[model samples]
Target: MDRPRCVWVRKADARVPGKLPIVYSKSYAVRFHGLERLHPFNAAKGKHIYKALCAEFSLAEGSFYEPEELTKHQLRRIHTRQYLRSLRWSLNVARIAEVSLMAFVPNNYLNHFYLRPMRFQAAGSILAGKLALDYGWAINLGGGFHHCCSNRGGGFCAYADISLLIVRLFDQEQCRVRRIMIVDLDAHQGNGHERDFSNWDTVYILDIYNALIYPRDNVAKLSIRSGAELPNHTEDATYLRQLGRCLMQSLAAFRPDVVIYNAGTDILKGDPLGNMDITAEGVIERDRLVFSTFRGLGIPVVMLLSGGYTKASARVITDSIVNLRQHGLLDLSPL
Candidate 1:
């Protein structure tokens, strides 16, 4: 296989004159004979967000950049061969997807119905990373599979897209992104990238997650340079306060060439899995604060929609993106 670096060596401009740097594709919606309804995660979340953004922004269908699916060779840049091989087994994919019935299905069917969408979403993340550098900011309507590391997959996260994005940028000479910060505001700790970058000083992780949630990896906590362990049912004020403190502290401790914001809406009240009580408005403000802090300082940001489990997640994310635009954080015009 050719080196992955060669794929990104062109450094072509990733922007059109008036379009937003949002990455998405129709393949991002995972559908499989109504089997997706068995899980709480909205399989069509990205499609919903895409439609809403187009309507709100008066964008045409082609306004957003649609990313192609990631090939196995591209995935090899970060994923282990064994891990990728494991994905070929329907039982293993069923475990990662948390849908027990998928274990009985054929691997080929599962690959096309489920894993293929994930690969496209992963590609969207890498594309968004490159776009962020050119446009000062970018958002992949899907991605933030933060539970999968280089060798394992779980928590409905089958791809280490966050690690892939960072690695791709570091490999490209023209990107010049030496230092990267991961602001994982998802309700669950981002153990995947944490594990991948544990010993890398150039990558700083600031994670604020519910302490009593799933995949409570104590070892991953050590990788977080600045972190907050929020209790179950934590509300807006407390969550926002801790986020502000961590953001300021992270900024003081280390400067970054780029910031990847995992803006998960699972913290919204009534979310079955997240167990947090933050409101939709709180989510909007959370995004605004993060975007303003980084964009105000002229730091490029790549936003990814992470582990939001409820049907309302898409609307909240759409509203948050609109709010960011209203706050002028998403303006792509010349500075």
Candidate 2:
């Protein structure tokens, strides 16, 4: 069997400085611990994890290929023009106001600056998807901003990267490929994805999440709900079993042409944001199941590291990437 080709996209600017003040009053300090206020920690931890994985796998250090800037015309394919314009203005105004009418602007002046990079990040994922069609696999180490909607942003996500990419692919007359399966294991419901792609027959989404968490409404509203919306404090074995079953069912039904995976590490035990309890080994096993399952079905996969919090959580995610590389789940052949 031939090895699959993987594209790793990481931009240094993607790591921006915190300009928003921590809102201490949003949630109860006891249960929530104001951890959500520590928004930059996850991104920092992700950088550490990526570095460790590169060293461990002896993978060549590669910079992200620059992608074309997302134009207003391109964004209009998925987002309403009015909404797009509003976001543009809100980003500029968000630096002064802690909150905006339709969206939360933690930092008024820096909103646009903080989110501006998502255009490139999203373009990278789109490129990765296209590359996967030829390479059999591609890994986008950063992306998976699944909580952002066409008109709203929340949950630390500012742009709907994969959704926009899917829309763009559909609009291109020459891109004949159809039937995309989005496998979201981010420990949170793929609200943004489900909302955008629900009516599109060619796109099928399988999202696994902790039921008792933020964005709870998303699980109930999935067009094709396949996985258990497990409760908080669920053990590792139970979660993995359910995930395996869901993957099997999705494979049998969708028989998709391509797989887009949101490999989030928040399910790890003691994750700052996640409520579930999964071990590092458990995360690796979950990755193996999803990647190997898609490969066995003869569908190419493009993986994006979605959401992971805490220091060790990133290490667990990095381990999964390394495992994929070692087992040839990710293509390493010279391009």
Candidate 3:
């Protein structure tokens, strides 16, 4: 297979010494005459997180790496051509975005306002994955569309970004990274990647999600190496304990070259969609635990901001990232 001309594959422009491997772009924000506001998924989630990280780190916008929009040719590496064609219809995009009103919008307008932003985020995921090999850690302020797979999309996910990232690395960096593990801490089960990687031994999935939520795909559960299904309103103590045990077990069972951390803030208390009760401190500690565990072992980690709703999600994520820096898990200084 011919490699797609992706920005991540180009090294000189990919990273700078001492700079954090944080991928983002203004194109990640979806805007369609304010119609995005009706959707529960924050249309500007990446933009908000980017601003917060800039303030917290006292960094200029140039400190971050920006990815270009993913072309259809690049998307075809994993997604089916028919599935890609379906997105050209407004009704299909409306269903994927969970915004029923978008059905009436013109497909061209939706392509510009919604799909274009998704393409940028999808490219960011691929960039962050490649950066992790160089920096030992990287974060994409956007991405983690875990509900969309190679041929299907749902739960406000229009692209299979996580799958794309995994495929890109496995294809381009096979010598360095033969095995990949997905640690999906999103409130919803990451059915997308699970379905895509099903029966593939190289990819190990460890998902912790509310069993009662949307896209309860029992079929996809077959791909998960370790999984914890939680009930509604489950608290942080229980969530974290299960997570710790699962992490240890997963590590013992299968060692991975890189870990994909889908850190979703939807588990926060009172989230309309997540339906869990994890506190802000709990979420911060959760991030610290994941980072310390992997980074301490010299394993590379690439983080993606997944399904977080509510206005406070951005603050919670920003705080969690700061806590990781304080713990020294984000240090990229040369020895």
Candidate 4:
């Protein structure tokens, strides 16, 4: 039986004719009473990358795709209603955010200043997934909220953007995208999506993470179709070799219609959380390998900027994106 095209996939607007398939929004910045300064993690990563891309790629403000905030209805598609409601509580949000001060902040400012940016980023992920199908590749300058699942939100992730993107694509582009693969290269384990898609054969997860880090859900490891758990301080060679092998093995095991690459720079040497020794050049090469493997096979790929804690993380990510362009893995020329 033929399937009808789903309406959830946003149609391309005429405003972005010369723009590449890069999804971003000014709202992606989490600015609230200078409280973003309190957190060690960089909250304005999307804005940093946007500025870098603007300077490097010769892009204007309106050149990128601006994603509307994801309404509760959209998030409810993957996340549980209880989980969504839990976000309204300052205590719950603070814990999920790993910011103690967030608990003191009132719900009005909490919801508006902090979670709203996340919603925009989450929606950007969904938009990127849709754009990837039309173009060969798409990049959501913000997103990769892998720490949130259907029933839970942890680590700094309040919404399961990865899960939502795949589910939306499955529900919308079902005929063309019957199967999708999540290549989570973040330094921390992607237990959220792992738990959400557990026992689901249609979604294959390839999570290469530092097994020693946070949310080391041994149970969630069961869902990974193929992946690697590196020890603390694993270097570039070992990391990339294992990644190459994993990509080859996962592709051989599952012929996916689309690939979701969680490109996280937290794996860099100085990152306090990632606990790995991968250099900036190593990070750039890592992105190239992932993009090459998927796009080379004619599979649509969506790149999400996931975990990156250090101040230099944004520069690393921006350099990697430029590397992808230079290597011909990402041709941002308007389709």
lDDT of each: 0.91, 0.65, 0.90, 0.89
Residue 105 lDDT in model 3? 96
lDDT score of residue 25 within candidate 1: 92
Q: In candidate 1, what are the lDDT values of residues 1-335, reduced to their tens digit?
A: 11223333556676777677999999998889999999888998999999998899878778888899999999999999999999999999999999999999999999999999999999999999988988899999999999999999999999999999988888774335878999999999999999999878889999999999988999988899998999999999999999999999999999989999999899999999999999998999999999999988989999999989888899999999988988888875632
Q: Candidate 3, which segments miss by more than 4 Å at Cα?
A: 1-14, 332-335
Predicted candidate 4 versus true structure: per-residue lDDT over 14-83, tens digit per residue: 3356778999998888998888887767888888998999999988678888899999899889988888
Runs with alpha carbons beyond 4 Å of true place in candidate 2: 1-37, 63-69, 89-112, 173-176, 218-220
* Candidate 2 global CA lDDT score: 0.65
Using lDDT as the measure, name the better of candidate 1 and candidate 3. 1
As a TM-score, model 1 comes out at 0.95
**Model 3: per-residue lDDT, tens digit, 306-327?**
9889899998998888889888
Output the worst ten-in-a-row residue range by lDDT, candidate 1. 1-10
- Give the alpha carbon lDDT tens digit for every residue of 37-109 in model 2: 4353344453565467557756444422334556667767677766666655654334212223323434433
**Residue 153 miss distance in model 4 (angstroms):** 0.6
RMSD of 2: 9.3
Q: Count the backbone clashes (under 3 Å) in each candidate.
A: 0, 9, 0, 0
TM-score of each: 0.95, 0.79, 0.95, 0.95
Q: Could you report the Cα RMSD, in angstroms, for every candidate shown?
A: 3.3, 9.3, 3.5, 2.7
Question: Could you tell me how far off, in angstroms, the CA of residue 216 lies in candidate 1 after the best superposition?
Answer: 0.5
